[model samples]
Target: MDAPLPPPLFPALAAPTDRPALRCGPDVLSYAELARAAGALAAGIAGSGRVAVWAAPTARTAVAVVAALLAGVPAVPLNPRSGERELAHILGDSAPELVLAGPADELPAALAALPRVDVELDGEGSGAVPPPAEADPESTALIVYTSGTTGPPKGVLLSRRAVAASLDALAEAWAWTADDVLVHGLPLFHVHGLVLGVLGPLRRGGEVRHLGGFSAEGVARELASGGTMLFGVPTMYHRLADALPGDPALVKALSGARLLVSGSAALPVRDHERIAAATGRTVVERYGMSETLMNTSVRPGGPPRPGTVGTPLPGVEVRLVEEDGSVLDGSDGETVGEVQVRGPNLFSGYLNRPDATEAAFDGGAAGGWFRTGDMAVREADGTIRLVGRKATDLIKSGGYKIGAGEIENALLDHPGVREAAVTGEPDPDLGERIVAWVVPSDPADPPADAALADHVARLLAPHKRPRVVRLLPSLPRNDLGKVLKKRLPRG
Candidate 1:
């Protein structure tokens, strides 16, 4: 009676061919091989309501997820490094029918209760490739958990439409085509790695080469061997920047690539300049979160703004809202506001948490917009420059609203400062005084607090200077290189 669901998220697998689809270390799968393997697995798990994947950076992980999509079942990607308590919470919340993992993967104790299915890298399906699933486009495809900075992780229900919309939008923005080949060593748990990295390549009818782990040499080797694009976080770029000076091959490989992208956190302007100076290639930046897949990205042909994440993707509407929920009229480039977005890329809701989900969206006569909780300023050119998170990176001092990201960037420019984080602490006179936690390049001869304060005051406004400075051996960060402000010492 109802119109059939749109074609499978990955149209390349429908009529499998011998074109390369995926490569992880020594393992490789052509479109036909992937279809046969995933189709067979899909037939076996067709009725499974949901499945959990021990998301390892391996070929098996990709096959497992594709199979689940073919079966019209939701797949929950579990971070292989998640703590026991976190794992237990996710397992209980999702209540997957079984767990799919690599043949040699050693899952943690929390996954012991679930039925286990080992995904074989070389096992092709017994018969002809099965047709794609005919399920509703609105059906949940994946249940990815949040980083849970505010509280325990919540499962974000991503729909088939949302995933397809996001990938297609990115394809348009990046000028992605079937002739492209992607290279990355990111983990499989997060959307950047699994969805954008793995699924993106397949949806484009292209190939993806996963390094299993990141390395400058590995990146060079792949890019030299026909890899057109490289996807990495800031940490990975930092390493490449460090390696570029000594490794001409690395520089050559990077220079020859069609695109280099950095996300998960802001790429410091200094690092951007270093890589560009050496390789003549600028690393493109994009902004997104678990709730919304891909909001904005610097287009392939557009100006590669170093600090900005570029304009909103095709079909995505972005708005900057004030504290009182009123939308700002236009971009001034200096006025900071909370980012809100509405588009097909948005998640359906948090799994089994209606109250939380209701609170997340601010709907009005103009449709619902998901609050990103990220603070940014929209440049006059329509590009968005993110300062930081609303909760941790926005600081109010001396009747001024200062973004900690700017000050951190300024501090990073200092030759003495290696890593920096900025936070605001309560003050008797200023309400909230700025604090700078820095890791010096030379701890034995660390820069003086007053000197650093003077440097910041001169670079920015006097009021934006750090009132307190704390020297640290290193900044506490997550796996993705995002600093953990809550974990920093207050005293």
Candidate 2:
């Protein structure tokens, strides 16, 4: 006999309650209303194989995703800002049966070929909760496409067990409960914004308030009212840090927030200090990727470390391995190794890419460890500090391994530097020379190359100093505000 299936992912939706569940701008949905709306939508989309959701930051988008989960159909979240070429590739790769979008959203020409269903936030239903789909827990619940850095984007298959495990682990780490309200302005397409930000609240029987878009004023207004937590990317927090000095309301709101979390990219130590100086609250950082929902996070009541991404969540085992596949024994905080994770939070596999999926794991099929491709240093206390990606961030110069993230952080500490990114380039003598691309705080009066290089040498090591510094007006960035190092121009 086989093991029994787990209960519904969102048990709060099974019964009627007048408590608010979701809020996007002025639109609000109580638990009772959300259940009826999602049940009706689920009934219509039942047996629809796989569906796509236009993940706009709205209550309707949330309903569509919930309906798909309730009906046991997989949902592929499409980024509304994705280019036509990228969107076309994803649609062809996933081959969703239908697309679900808000009633007022105007999709681009690339989506015209697919069938669409307009989700109405205020639509009526039978006032009955839909039964959980009778399916194995290992079945796919979401197919999230990764950002295609090396090649075309591949669809990642995430199972219901993985999602549930990740959420439960996070709850234990953060001490999350039904009384906590999460406030964020993240796009609903990726795991940080969708799985943790939107679905997390629903699973915990809490409320989520999505700011149509992120703004310092909106964050202050919401947190000042009743919001308890804030989830944001580095860019969003950087803006908050910049605005906190001038906005008293923002400071008060942040000081009162139970938790302020940052992910998707590393939050600079400078930004963390600035916010703490103003609000007396420290921002917690977590590490994760598309293949792994969440591997590590700084516990809410644990020690406060600004540069590290805390310890692994409960049930997630994290290890650093050498190039020869030997696992590192102890955390010394100096040795850099590739991050490998094994846990229930791991994804099933990549959709239609068996070769890629197999390549992502190490030690054969039985190993069960997913190679994250991210490089990090484990501290003495078991905290993980991510240095950078192996492909782009690990710089081998002068017979030494150097991480670009630490150099970038040192550069940002200089008063003249506004933004910085580090990469390695081919050199005649050194195997790979360290190069620094900097955005000066003042374009009219940029810091000299010698001064900046000497600043880094004094703060870090002499060998880690940039061999060459290129000053730019601004650094190229993505929608989530991560610096696009690949797009940086080489001299």
C-alpha lDDT of residue 102 in model 2: 89
Candidate 2, residue 183: how far the Cα is off, in Å: 0.5
Worst 10 residues of 1 by lDDT: 124-133
Clashes of each: 0, 0
The runs of at least 3 residues in candidate 2 whose Cα sits more than 4 Å from the true structure, single-residue gaps closed, are: 1-5, 132-134, 365-367
Please report how far candidate 1 places residue 17 from its true position, in Å: 1.0
Q: lDDT by residue for model 1 over 376-434, one digit each (tens)?
A: 99899888999889999999888888889888988887889989999999999998999
